[model samples]
Target: MSPRPFDHVVGKNLTSVKFPVVAGLPGPEGLKTHLRGHLLRMSNVGALRVLVTGATGYIGGRLVPRLLEAGHQVRVLVRDPAKIRSVPWADGVEIARGDLTDAASLREPFRDIDVVYYLVHSMNSDGDFEEAERRSAENVASAARDAAVGRIVYLGGLHEHSDRLSTHLRSRTQVGEILIDSGVPTMVLQAGVVIGAGSASFEMIRHLTNRLPVMTTPRWVNNHIQPIAVGDVLHYLAAAATAATSESRTYDIGGPDVLRYGEMMQIYAEVAGLARRRILVLPVLTPKLAGMWIGLVTPVPLSIGRALIESLSTDAVAYEHDIDAIIAAPSGGLTPYRDAVALALRNAENTEAGWDGAAADPLPTDPAWTGEIVYTESRDAVVRADPQRVWEALLHWSSRHGHWTVENKQEPTLLELHGPGRARLQWRIESVTPARTRLHQHASYIPKGLPGQLYWLGLKPLHRIGLRRAMQSVIKESEGRR
Candidate 1:
């Protein structure tokens, strides 16, 4: 939660900044003219009152801090404010409770807002998400029109328009069209495969690479993708707000390098310092089967895996470079694909703990207290070191000769360690920040028969104390290493 290095970029004089123009686009003089006009438009408006939807989502969660640092008055609309309560920037902005499907709830949040960032989507919702997305977009467009919002900025999937378009891509395209036609100037930045820590795509890649030394593939793995770094995407989203444009426009945003999905996995492995994985590209594996396999092997849900697999069947490379003419590249220009992976890995390594809040009860519902009695005990600690350090410390604990056993002998039967994924007994290191790590230790057991139940009850107090002390030991050891 400490101040980010990019805080200086906010509230700075835009006119003094120099933006790079892509080849075949405007030259330096033309770039100067465009900047003059853009700055003039920005000056006339002064500071903008921005309302951000999907503030609980990955991109929206990161975007809020950037907007606030840029000196904009920010407000967030969410169906459940508790979802964002633990965010480092939560206390700095206005919070309004509302759902996109309910148009009535949108009025107050939309009021007095100059720009609206529509980051909401129904990809993970139950039932038909496509229909849900359509309804949500229509409601948002209507509400934006009613609120007299000057502009709307949206991030959507990058894909070619075709009868064969995947449902997820089609839904994203439909939402963009709806926003554009709302009579409010809307800027849509279409991108594919945003690489960053805590992102679904990145997490899938991380888990798959770390756990599997070999992987079976689908034919879609050969399809080309132009993955953009989350940092670059954030840069574009933040800059689009100030670009001088009178009409709605769509820009294709991507990184400098284009590679196939399989190549992406290889590069990630290389960056993460894992051994090169052997991948067999089997044409027989259908998207459905691939999704099921991904779900079973990694933490990614089948639905999300299917969507990602479907999108990988088509090329997502950008055909336009107009975004460069508008917003300048970051200080070092667009991050290369390998560099982006390395940065994401670095972020993962430095990830802090405590951001996930508390672990959910692992037991299933037992209304009548019949059948086997199940119980779970969890201990969480925030360590000063990064997740990588915490993970290494835990690995050391697990590898000790007879540490986790009773009496330090008899084959160490006290507890077992399992996972890099969703194993029953596991220690997970989740990233909260660049310098902090959250260590979550969990143990679950189901007692069968009366004797087993009595045994668990008898040892419950000791179990609690042992788990808490173990977590404290981890924290102390990790801090010492730091």
Candidate 2:
């Protein structure tokens, strides 16, 4: 990177930034983008006024801020207004309450929009998801056309152009066709599995690879897939808004590496520092059976697992690289599969910022007893003081204590203590009700072998005593504070 661009990388840890590198152009580029967008937002000059659906979803949530940094005027449309009330960027954009399935509801939001970003989709819903997806896309198309919207940018899934496409990919492709025929200029950037924290496709891969040491997998594990980084997807989506293209079209976008589905899992294991997983591909396993197995073993929900598995049943490698013409590649390049997974893992260090990490470790959401046997002990108490007071009290206790260091903290909410080798102590503070707070302390240890097991056994009683004393001291200090 040039010195001018690298200079913009100051005041931020490039590694821990939300978007890890397409191998750190994402971080520095992200910073540079933010600087430019901030200036544009301040001047209110030459900004693209756009409306985005799915603002609360994984991609939309990340994209909204990027659009803002690009100095674009963003308006988010949602069925429920409260869904976006607490987001960091909520105050920065206009929020319109409307249902995409209801064409009448979309007309108002679609009006006066230079670009319409159709990022919403009905995935794994209770009703007919395909019909819902189609109707929603149709409504968006008609509304954009009637409102004379300048551009339509839709993020769809990549798949081989075949009648045999799975239900999920077929619906995605159909939605693209509907938008392209809407008499409005649309650019459908179809991407394969997007690798990032909080992405559904990536989450499925993370959980499955982390938890299962061995998999009795489906035949689709052999299917070729091209996975794109979330940053790259956002990059293309942002560019799609500005590119002065000739006509409405669909373009396939992906990372530099393409590999089989099972290969993705093993690569994730390598990135995550886990033992290579064992696998036995059986022809007898169907998508339904495998999905059920995934649901049982991993944190991914059954409906989504089934849909994702079905999509993976066929090769999803990008058929072309036509998108290179409109938007130049990232400064470094697109994040390769290994680098993307590394970025995802690196981003996991900030679990306080709503990143669901520790797929190979332990998760609060994963099914109980899914992976290796982990021993944990938890203690909870209601405190009379507030969270901040309790945190201060805990800090005081830690300062007086020995052999413990602050591993990570979320201020008055969570404080983590890092111990030697896989032994962890977590203190979670929550508001039970008005003027009442609950402080929960949890300890977990994953023993390696006989000696490790003996170490845990030896520390078991000492651990209990230490936790009780720490809780007592913190509680005393908290209630004592004014």
Candidate 3:
């Protein structure tokens, strides 16, 4: 098959022209074409205004900042305002509370937007995701057409061949078609497993290798595929909007080399410093079994895991090398799998700013369990002091004690606890209803500066006792009354 024609090349800027699209944009059919031209011209100045859907999503979160950096005014379409608030540019972005399934909410966000990125997909929408995607696409297309939006950009799955497209891939393609059918010039960039921090595919590899000593593989593990770095993917997305000529094109973008899933796992294991274990692949290890095993070990939700594994039967390696014709070679070129893994780990090391990471009150030791070098304890404590007193105790819980740290593969540094002397108690006492104050203690140790019980799992009994005493000394500080 001929490689899909790239309507525009890298660095080419697309401006709207007077066409049938504009002529048809009047009634319920909408004066979308004409409006698109005007909106494009209005945004062509130094500051182009772009609206991004799914701002809180993995791709959306990273893509928003990239757009802003490229000198575009970015607005986000979000279902829930609170979720995207933690984004670094939270204040800068204009958030519109809209859902793809509901066309009514889209009109507000679609108004006066020059380019719309339809990055929203309902993978977890439950029961007929295809229908959900179709409806969402139709709704967005209608709204964009009505609002006279131009240049819809969609990021889709890498399809080796149209005849063998998986349901996921097919639905994604259909979504792009729906947008194009709206008479809006659209550019679709399809890519395979995006390797980067917090990406589902990368996380699957992280947890699977970290938790399991040996993997019982499936047949799909031998399927050939090309994985692209998330950074590269972001570059293409940004490049797509600026390319003047590349409208109404579908570009299959991927890494330089194609490797089987088994090789991919081996590369990951090497980068992670894991043991080169025997991967016993049995023909009978069906997709169902593989999905169950993945769910057991990885952070991937079962439903999504199953869908992902089931789709692995076909090779997703890109056959078309058309992307090279449009854009210049990236400075770093295509990222190797091992290099990608290392970068992702580095990024994971700095995820403290994530909203889900804030600490609550500390508690007492409950039932405890110890891993290879990590110890976990759960406890509930009722202190007679005020919440402020409890907070002080928890904050300083490791101050006087030996810090618990875990020596992992990446760095022989701390896993959970912040460095000593830097731990500050930041909290305000809410309404103190009663004399008894509640506390929830959650302690984590990094294996550098401090010694905690969890970090002594494989150590000698004496070392474990010594560490426990050190920790207890710190916990004792909180026992004092307010």
lDDT of 3 at 93: 83
Candidate 1 residue lDDT tens string, 296-393: 87667777777777777788889888877667787788889898777665523111233322111111111122111246787777789876666666
Alpha carbon lDDT at 197, candidate 3 = 58
Q: Rate the local accuracy (lDDT) of all candidates.
A: 0.70, 0.76, 0.62
lDDT of 2 by residue, 246-328 (tens): 35789999999989888999998898777888989999999889888888876678888888888888898889898987678
The local distance difference test score of model 1 is 0.70
Q: Which is the leading candidate under TM-score?
A: 2
TM-score of each: 0.67, 0.76, 0.73
Tens digit of per-residue lDDT, candidate 3, span 451-472:
2322434554654465455344
lDDT measured at residue 386 in model 3 versus the true structure, 0 to 100:
56
- Weakest 10 consecutive residues, lDDT, candidate 1? 358-367
TM-score of 1: 0.67
Total clashing pairs for each candidate: 6, 2, 29
Residue 139, model 2, lDDT:
88
Residue 265 lDDT, candidate 1, scale 0-100: 87
- Rank candidates, TM-score, best first: 2, 3, 1
lDDT of 2 at 476: 81
